[model samples]
Target: MLKLGVNIDHVATLRQARYRGREQGEPDPVRAARICEEAGAHGITCHLREDRRHIVDRDVFALRRTVRTRLNLEMANTPEIVAIALQVKPDIVCIVPERREEVTTEGGLDVVAQEPALTETRRRMNDAGIEVSLFIAPDPPQIEAAARVGAQFVELHTGRFAEAFGDPAQREEELNRLVEGARLAHRLGLRVNAGHGLNYENVRWLHRVPHLVELNIGHSIISRAVFTGLARAVRDMLDAMAGYTGGMPGAA
Candidate 1:
């Protein structure tokens, strides 16, 4: 099965929004994770941003102690977060780009441009025995740079592919690039995972990408939960991946 790493950031976002004026059950991300586990999520992903925007330090520690499945920590390459990661030591850590102004993760980390800094961060995280994944684009240079930095995994950002869903030609082109990138990464001995902007409509679009072991989905699944419930929403997406019949876009 294609593993599903459910991102509970939006769950925290909702609670934070409500906490602006009212309070309820504290709206813990760990609790939301348990709900995801019970709903059949293969793993849990949380980003501990510099701003404490959504998931916080406490949430990361709590998940490390609580979750039965793997925990993938999303963070930027900063001394503070890197130090915290050394102490918490989740199953996996994905390094990403961070900006105080952006509403959310707007794009993939420019690993090619920041190779030296990224290389050092990757070394520290790997030495601590935590799997390091680079959240990069489907560009060949970025993919190559990730491997050179000694990262064991690379998560291709699917924001472009998802946005292109409206235009068949654009969507097909983006999917093809991702498919090729995944194949190339796997050949270089790196685990390939994809996420961001992926929804029910484009869930199975990357099945043709070789060696794709996991997909981390957030906003779309959580939003759909408001209508279909979390478990059903997750299960429905899993079912789509398992039932994919067209041999993916570039399965040649």
Candidate 2:
């Protein structure tokens, strides 16, 4: 089944905006995870950035304890974060590129250049019985590097496709890239999951890319929750994801 992993990082972002140094805060990420799971989210995802701009160590530990479903931890491949991930023991970890200045993840992790470090991290996580995924752009080289690092999954970055959605020609080109990327990753024995810039409207177009196990979405759902409530927001995305036949239509 196509699963939805609700990212509650922004919930913590909201809390930290008002209660950064305080011990207590509103809009707890753990509570958000609970609500998302209750509303039929297949998993909860949170990024513990090195800067601690949003989701903090305490919140990750709490989610590790409280999240009933799966907990997919998104982290940079830094030693500090790797150590914390080992202690937290999240179900899966998607190693991603990080920058202090960028407001968010601006691009995919360069698995090709960082293959040695990523391979070591993947081994450690596998040793701890944690599945490892590489958050990479839908490119053949990166996907191959992910397989080389022995990652169990590759989360194809859909930011480009989402950015191109307004133009039919560009959207089709990006969609074809994603379709081909998914096919290559699957053939290399890697499970596929995609995210970034997926929203209620654009997500439905992803059926053309085959072998998608889940989509980890955040900003759009949380923004929608501001008006429609979190549960409704989640259900609406699920509704959008429904009826995916997983056929690679028009894929070369």
Candidate 3:
């Protein structure tokens, strides 16, 4: 079955907005993670950005101690963050591109350009027994580069697909890109996980893209929690992810 890795970064975003520079805050992300796992999420995801935008060191460490399910730590391939990952040792580390200016992650990491550095980081992560995943756009070169770097997984950046949801032609094109990306990644011996802008309505279309192991989602679930509450929001996403039967029949 397809799994849901509930991203709790946005819950920390809300807390930081009101309580930045404070010692304590309401709506703790660690607590939020426990609720998500209890609601049947397979894992918890949080990005510890360099700028300390949302999920912070405190939150990451707290999650490492508290999360019952797996912890997927989203991070940039930087020296400082790499060292921390070695120390904290989350279940998996998804290497992504980071820019302080963008409101959110604008796109995937260019693994082709940064192959040498990324390969080293992946090596370090694996040495520490933490599996490495690269967040890349659904393109052949990036997918191939990820395999070359020895990444265990590649999370296809779904922003473009989500953005094109309103336009039928564009949406189909984007979906095809993801389909081909997943197929290539699987054949290349990499596990597949996708995220970024995935939500209740648009996620139903993802069944077309085969071999998805998990979807890391945050903003949509947190927004929905305003009315339905966190546990219910998580359960609702799992419901939407139901009935996926894996798109490629005999391919693993």
TM-score against truth, every candidate: 0.93, 0.98, 0.98
Q: After superposition, how far is residue 105 of candidate 3 from its true place, in Å?
A: 0.9
Local accuracy of candidate 3 as per-residue lDDT tens digits, 1-252: 999999999899999999988879978999999999999999999999999988889898889999888999999988899988898999999999999999889899999999999999999899989999999999999999999999999999999999999999999999999999999999999999999999999998998899899999999999999999999999999999888867755332
Candidate 2: residue pairs that collide: none
- Locate the minimum summed-lDDT window of 10 residues in model 3: 243-252
In candidate 1, which residue ranges exceed 4 Å CA deviation? 20-25, 244-252
Residue 28 miss distance in model 1 (angstroms):
2.3
Per-residue lDDT over 1-252 for candidate 2, one digit per residue giving the tens place of the 0 to 100 score: 689999999999999999998888989888899999999999999999999999999999999999999999999999899999999999999999999999888789999999999999999999999999999999999999999999999999999999999999999999999999999999999999999999999998998889999999999999999999999999999999987767456522
- In order, the Cα lDDT scores of the candidates are 0.86, 0.94, 0.94
lDDT of 1 by residue, 1-252 (tens): 578999998887877765633434367778889988987889999998999877777778989999999999999999999999999999999999999998779789898899999899888888889999999998899999998998999999999999998999999999888988888898788899999998887887677666788999989888888899878887877776674323455433
Q: How accurate is candidate 1 locally (lDDT)?
A: 0.86
Better of 1 and 3 by lDDT: 3
How would the candidate models be sorted by lDDT, starting from the highest?
2, 3, 1
